[model samples]
Target: MADYADITYAVAERIATVTLNRPEARNGYTIRMADELGDAMDRADRDEEVRVVVLTGAGRDFSVGADLSQGGFDFDPESGPDAAWQEPAGRCSKRIFTMHKPVIAALRGAAVGGGITITLSCDYRLAAEDARFGFVFTRRGIYPEGASAWFLPRLVGMGTALDWMISGRLVDAAEALSAGLVHRLYPADTVLEEAYALAREIIATTAPVSVAVTRQLLYRMASAPSPFPVHELDSRLIGGLGKSSDAVEGVVSFLQKRPPEFTMRVDRDLPDYLPWLHDSI
Candidate 1:
């Protein structure tokens, strides 16, 4: 694994864990951190050995948003060396958005500002009982970034999205879970362990190719014009997989009451339509 200054990366048992490492700053985010995160996520996505990714912070907090020591100047787009501007925070979110494997967020302590937006793009977010969050850009005299304005409404309903962004109030883990922002909540000390357990369920029982293809279809088709596109993709995938070795093994294992050994690899076994290959489309 490549070295990263702001985050730690490790893959074990088909699960990749990306840790935000700036505990002293409460994991305050920075542009460098964003680049490092994007790099780490990309690494996990391309590694065929990896089936799931878990993102969590190192210590007391997930991230308190950007490193604001420079105050307003920190957000000045013109201040950065890159002249052709794009939203720096959004790039990391996009990386998570595009990943083939499921990305799960394990949140403890303060998950506010960029912290919340970043996790919004993840497939599932699990919060510690002590977790607290806010869409605090309005309170900070800015608006939501990291393409959160787009993702927030989709994850939580538009009414809830507007309420949070408009009020910019800090919320507890219970509320976040109630609002559907996170899947479940656990004690802070056990949250990371819980995340791994969830990942194991996926790794142990699910077919890698099927998981990858299903993730793609769900994310892509959610914004689709109609269900027809999803149906088309589903028909293609179901038909293709019906004759695959993994499919046969899956059935026989179920009947025999044994664990399945899915041999199909996501890297080479996926049909062209799954990833929307240029030639196939």
Candidate 2:
């Protein structure tokens, strides 16, 4: 089973749990997994039944970064077609940042290199006390890929970022917590349960629209300056849903102290490149 597809996504009770399913190779990411992941995010974001997403690994290690057997991802002096080939795999990790639904990374084991970038994109990062995070790009003679170069410094200060990237060291869960890389830590056996418990708590109180809007706002804030025209986008996003039955139910449910029968379908109009739009302009 560990040698099966590298990714798996399933939705149940309004939550989607996406597993990095490859365990034998320590769940290392392959180009094929990247392609599958891109499609999975699109499906989750569009599915009305899914309110939250959890990312985890199936085995002892979360991921050991890029899979080397399938042609190792190494830097090449020539930057042309080779760059395009490399871009797709990197984009797989970036999709986590762009996806609108709330994501939680439930870490239980080794999260290294590109794996660390995937963990960072998640809204809430929960790790097992024994889990270790390694920044191995420098050790492998490659610069960080998959948005880590930009995301790491923001999560941890520039100095800490440099320490991790330059020194190529592995930080355990406690250090990751102190460094601001992880939000909470649990014993290894209970980490997944705690992650689900946390997700359930959010589901209980958060309005779907508010959660989606807040996620969108955070993505924009992370990528650009404040007063970031997000309000305009927010209004547009809400306006499209204003007439939905879920909107009416949501407003009435709040007044009546009843659970909202949220039926608003995810708008297909949401741009795929929302996070990069500001930079593009």
Q: Could you say which candidate leads in TM-score?
A: 1
Query: Cα lDDT of all candidates, in order?
Result: 0.86, 0.77
Candidate 1, residues 50-94, lDDT tens digits: the string is: 999999999899989888662433355566645555565787887
Q: Tell me the lDDT of candidate 2.
A: 0.77
- On the 0 to 100 scale, the lDDT of residue 110 in model 2 is 91
> Which 10 residues in a row give candidate 1 its minimum summed lDDT?
272-281
Q: Record all residue pairs in model 1 with backbone atoms less than 3 Å apart, i.e. clashing.
A: none
Listed per candidate, the RMSD to the true structure in angstroms reads 2.6, 4.1
lDDT for 249 in candidate 1 is 92
Estimated TM-score for each candidate: 0.92, 0.82
Model 1 scores a C-alpha lDDT of 0.86
Q: Residues 1-281, candidate 2: write the lDDT tens digits.
A: 22227688887877888888888888888877777777777788778778788888898888888887877544453653553355544676578777767888899889998777766778889999999998887888987887787778888899999999999999989899999999999988888888888888777766665567567677665554556477666666676665566667878899999876664444643344455444531
As a whole number from 0 to 100, the lDDT of residue 229 in candidate 1 is 79
